[model samples]
Target: MKTALSLCLLTMALGGCGNIAAVKSFNTPYGSPTSGDTARLRVIADGMVRAVPGKDCVDWYSPGAGVIAVPQKGFADRNGESLGMPKGATAMQGDVVSEVLVPAGKPFTLHFLDGGRGSYNSVTNCLGMFYFVPQKGADYEVVVHGYSACGVKLQQLGAEAPVQVTKAEYCSAMANF
Candidate 1:
């Protein structure tokens, strides 16, 4: 499992992970701007693969696709849409956060950016994907802990009464990832 995740991450680091140009089909053009009210989203996506006690790894596949978001109308597409996170664990991984503007008021599925491998030898350790709805004008912070599990966690980082997060505060919070 570790080897697979490592390979995926390596591919991503080498620019082999699914890229916008690598996808042959699409619901919209690659890198198209949000079509409606958009909210800023900050994500700390992780691609680490951890071993769970007594559980066989089912997601040992290759081609880490970085982070991906698909609207309800679009099928899975391989592209480097996530913030810059590496394929495996490294001291520099903390720097690989992503911020993007996505359509608000719609539910989108989030996929692991590191799951862009061409095929799979197993199934359990498959990358985790989740759903989210971004409120118009609201900003969100999400943390993706690993690839082999559904560790996608999120919180609203903005204050309702117009409070801005300080660099110190954000840096402190990011350390948890």
Candidate 2:
């Protein structure tokens, strides 16, 4: 009886050791909108990306609204090419291409998690939070990269350069507490 109890406790403890956080699926309104009050934002992630609603910054420890993006399977084979990685960066099997609508001129935040090897008990997992304001009727793309050190870049679709974005200020403060 004692051995069985110990085994059960061990299983429970190990179950919670993974680096990935539990998040719901974020749902965008059906039918693409052509209004100037909204903008299209594409999220590309090798692991997963969570869209946290509201302008306020949220920390990593806290759960967000839900996961908005995940890695796409067989995307590279379908396209027969890569989806444009930054110079000196290695490409994953397939990056997730998820599009969603965001309020124009409003602040939006995203939490990025690296698809590190081994979902459970992974030491290479990295997390990053970034916020940006979208312009009306414009399309934007957010690319997330890295494992041990995650990086996020935002750029307007068809633009040659990436736009400047800052990390969530609240997350830093929360870390101090």
Number of the top TM-score candidate? 2
For residues 52-128, could you state the per-residue lDDT of candidate 1 as single tens digits?
11111212121121223332223342223454322322223432454566556655334443433324554434465
Clashing pairs in 2: none
> Which residue window of length 10 is worst by lDDT in model 1?
49-58
lDDT of 2 by residue, 1-177 (tens): 897676556545544323112111222212223454877776666766766544546543433344566563311111122333333223455665656676678667776666566564575676777788888877787778655446777888777878777676554553211
- Model 2 ranges with Cα > 4 A deviation: 1-36, 59-64, 72-92, 118-123, 169-177
Report the alpha-carbon TM-score of model 2 versus the true structure: 0.59
Measure candidate 1: CA RMSD: 14.8
Model 1 misplacement above 4 A? 1-35, 48-95, 113-126, 147-150, 159-177
